[model samples]
Target: MTMQLLLTLLLAVARVKASTLLASHYSGQLYTLSLSSTNQLSISGSISSGNRMPAWLDLDSASRTLYIPDEVQWGQPLLKSFTVGTDGAVVPKEQIQTSGGDLHSTLYGGPNGKGYIALAQYDASAISTYPLPLTGAGQPLQKLTFTMPQPGPVPSRQNKPHPHSVFTDPSGQNLLSADLGADLIRVFRVGTNGTLAECSPAKSGAGDGPRHGAFWTRGNSTLLFTVNELSNSITAWSVLYQPGGCISLLKRQTTSTFPPGKSAPPGSKAAEVRVKDNFVYATNRFDRSFGAQEDSIATFSIHAASGNVTFVETTSAHSFFPRTFSINAAGTLVAIGGQTSANVAIVERNVTTGRLGRLLASLKVGNPGAANQEDGLSAVVWNE
Candidate 1:
């Protein structure tokens, strides 16, 4: 072949490796999402997650599997597994009963290609650890279970322990669970045998109701950024690694998820919080009771040295109830899921300023069950 022709063929192959975005919904389906050159998003394919509400979605690329919680019925929570194909298709594999209901899960990559799948149950107020098998056929075996403690200020949501999410630390030797009802980020030491042991917690301001969190590290300092649902704000905590590999979090700063002087409407709550580059993005959602609402994504610039956050600006999400969003690996695009609108929107990001540009794409995915209009988009994940 001619050298020119060879080079052209190589470029085309490289383009095919571009990342694909996946979105899960309250409708009980997961869609393979793609954004075209024309800035239009298309659903390439979809897999049914059954009737259960897959409120959270995450991919384990190393194992080529997807983990989801089946909280369809109270007192009968399940952990579902699926094999993710190269073309972004998913095949349902196994479903095992978990320790509790309303669970959110994540995989911990551990020693020798063997690790555990960690789940946090909201209704049961517990964390369950299980052995992750490579075959993806048999039921998962439980290794340990930890009941989370609830300490509160908000009477409505803080009536009990509510573990919103579970995350494996970068060190692979610890775990962090964001307890929304407790106003604390609890730390746990991951034993070599996959058991969990409690450690000192990083406390948030009362009534904060800390939800989900994302971590970023620079040098020896690791920072955890969490979204506060009740307060409509975000908090940053500096992590201190102890001598025995245990860790603690110290609150560094908190900032409103809404624009300055613009009080969030009543019943307003903050949802997902994500970090990319030196910036953090969070969603602000409000109930329909607020006539003129401000449902948007607030972007903030993070100081690398101090892990402090400064509000940059708020950008309209182009829809209501943006429950979740994912940034492409390239850091040039962001996909947001509007739960109440049953639609997804894409926006461009300014890498230099960390400010969002105008919305580039918007399309309705339709609600899960009926053909009618009712928002149900739940979570979004970017697979690069």
Candidate 2:
């Protein structure tokens, strides 16, 4: 073979080897999947978590550590840590009991400049923080509970404060928790001693149910875009850095997660929200009845000056009830996991246009379950 052809073949092989994905399931399993350069997807390995439900995963690439939150409804859930091998498999390191019903978490710098995990416990109506480098099961460093006088507009879904997700701001000085039950985004200041002090919270529209959010920074302005699960919409907020380490959010606009002239169907809810280079992507679940047997991933463009968001289009998620989806580090591919369908899908993404092109590959890893039962896939993350 000519030298040019040999170099091309080597590059192709590298592309295939780089496209590994780590997927978590509600069935107590973590899977290592691979996507070929030609878009073929295959399961390479898996390990039983032995936990009730490992719902969310936060990866620390610098340390090659994976933090998984076990979401349990009744008993105390566990926060497990593992060392990810170079081959994409994981080895369990430690497990610590956390507050119940931990749905989502994020790793961020603590007050003392150490790594910390902020956990959002949905059922416990609390936010807990744990020190990094887990050694074994131990007490949380801090746990803050929330309460309200009465439920929001949707009493059934907003009976108490349910913190769905926890994330850090662009400066990493403040931590924000999206409380779905109370329709509020709670803010906390990271102190020098690794403690969190409560700051003023940002209130969303009644019944908006802010679940997950992403931050966008341009020049000196920072904007927050959140997917509201109850209202099936997205809200953009102008972030204001306060005098100290605290921050505030000024609501800008709210738009439907669906495309123009469209609305969510009955029992449909928005799931995940991710902000890429110049676009925002969110998942809508239970809306597959409109067209295909699959859910939809909605894309929106961010206005350069005002940081406003406008809906772009919607694409098939290639799975049913897509609860979570992750974009590759290159932003060239997306892996979506369906909760009820028990399927994982890979789709090509146009980084320039910020539009998902087509379904590349999909695989069924487990059996389907009911909508309410968390029996299938829960989350997907690129191993890179």
Candidate 3:
């Protein structure tokens, strides 16, 4: 064989191996997908979740446990846990009934040095905490409810307090909830024995409707960046870690998620926000103006000192209504789940320039549906 041909064969043999990805669908299924080094995608396995709308998933790598929240709007929702086997099989472990509309959850360490699951119930206007290693249908250790004194600027969406997401801060001492209906980022202190105490909330712009957030730390500074669904904007806040396991978010900058001089379409809404290295990425849904086929993912460059972000560019998601997406551990590929398109797209990413490249692969997993109807894909997560 020729020398060049021999080198090519060797490179192919040494290429990155395929990885596993877990995706949640509104059709009550958890799918295990195989992602090849060449960026191809295929469903390897799937299991029924036994719930109507398992809309969000949180995987605890340390325990090989996956937490799924049933985003049911009508009756009481359920929080289910499963053991993820080595072969990608998910075995149900426990299921607990919770207040309706359990949309998001996260695992965090409590003051007792044990782990706890913090859940956000949007329709219920409540937050709940449960101890880790769920065994049975146990009750929550603490449940907190919120009431909005007045309607927000956007009365339609902010008529009540809706906590969209609950996440642990960088300090690992506090929990923050993005209250979309109240225009506040509610702070909570994790106390001994996995209890939660309410703290002063940080205010956002009127009608911002903060849905989800990601944190970035530089030296001693930590910044919280939230994707506002109502305003179609991104806001950066300086996270101040205070004594007694609490925090204060001071607003730093607010910028449109769309490109400069461009705004979101009438029905468009910002979905997800994520940070990798020095770059931040946010998604916009129902905006076909950017792409003929689907919505767009907005990229921004983060200023090291101020934590302010500058708009980088927008890239087509290659699928309609990109509700959720996950970046691999290598940060080289993005797996996007289109909520209304019922498809998953793998796109190349540039770690150095913070720019998204061409679409490598796309797979149709199920049937499509209307926006926010809970009839398609809900979450996509890498298994690394």
Candidate 4:
């Protein structure tokens, strides 16, 4: 290893204590993130990948490995894993070749936090489940792919396998894949040893273009809320939990994201949707247009029982493209990430009523776009 690389590792370990970071790849490398003692200071760290691109990073607690959706021309995009040393150097662990084309995003965990990775080939639509190992290095998973129901009413776009994001159900009995191209959410059932059992499909209503989704809170709830990139809105759905190993949608309704104006373009979808406490936050991106640089964070109060969301307030933070933001372990501060600015904004939130405040300390991103909108901020990972 080069001396420069070794020095980079030592600096990272000093900046963060008691918390690890989520590394995002963009502008050609992955960025490390962390918060201050008060969860205010947002820090960025990076490790170079000669020609490999790091995308859609996931922290696998069971394996203590950071998984990156890496693209290398030699073969296919891999679910590459790494071990973070005590001094913060990320040592490569495993590079599992995905059978179902390029691995998109590490699917959100099920009710039990059982990890699964979702693979989506643009021309095809499906989800694959990788059993999260119980301990030690994460076990290599055999791709258990679930092709979506093609003959549904909206078969034109829905005909192909276009899985975007995957997550397990609150009961851990089901897995769901949000199909952006198809505008439908696919569901599945899981076994103890990480086997998937098929079941019913819970629709996300018409043309919502579901992107990344999450529940109102952890454990126990029929409320499933998802971020719809096309519709430029977030929606709530009441799940009719059934006894026959199936879940039916009870209701699907939308919430406002932007003020009445030109709708979001086709490609730049809603980035990351997260639910902390009773508040659900969505970050809508302009990717290219970069028009409304004023209003960013869309805050909504979540109703867990009815699966409904009411507008709390839209943050006027001047972030270019806020993609992903995470509340601190104390839920006091939220670290906001911009896909275009390549910088993170540290914002404070009132956990009681879902109000937000800007923080004092901010970490300017490294390797910033010495150029333009083609690059900006990546994802944000917080340390407790």
* Clash count list over all predictions: 0, 0, 0, 7
lDDT against the true structure, each candidate: 0.75, 0.86, 0.86, 0.60
lDDT of 4: 0.60
Model 2: which ten-residue window has the lowest total lDDT?
9-18
TM-score of model number 3: 0.93
Candidates 1 and 2, the one with greater lDDT? 2
In the predicted model 3, the residue pairs found to clash are none
Model 3 lowest lDDT segment of ten = 6-15
Better of 2 and 4 by lDDT: 2
TM-score of 1: 0.87
Q: Against the hidden reference, what TM-scores do the models get? A: 0.87, 0.94, 0.93, 0.76
Instruction: Give the alpha carbon lDDT tens digit for every residue of 1-384 in model 2.
Output: 987677556545556654778888888888888787777788999998757899897887777888899888767667888889766889998887765688998877754344788889998899988878765566788899999999999999999999999998888888899999999999999876557899999999999999999998889989999899999999999999889779999999999988777768888899999998889999999898436567898999998887888889888988888999998877777889898898998887776788898777999876676885778888888887
The residue-by-residue lDDT of candidate 4 on 1-384, one tens digit each, is: 987676556535534554445546465466555454454544435665322545455665545566665433344545666676533456666555554334355544444464555454444354544554323333444454445555444465445556677766666667777777667667766655556566766566566677777876535566777888666788787766778666766556787576445555554456678878888888766534435453367788876565567777666444666767777665656777666556667776765677777653556575554222434555666532
Overall local distance difference test of candidate 2? 0.86
The candidate with the higher lDDT, 1 or 4, is 1
Clashes of 4: 7
Clashing pairs in 2: none
Model 4 segments more than 4 A misplaced = 1-20, 37-45, 49-51, 61-63, 71-74, 85-89, 99-104, 107-116, 120-123, 131-159, 217-220, 259-268, 287-295, 304-307, 366-376
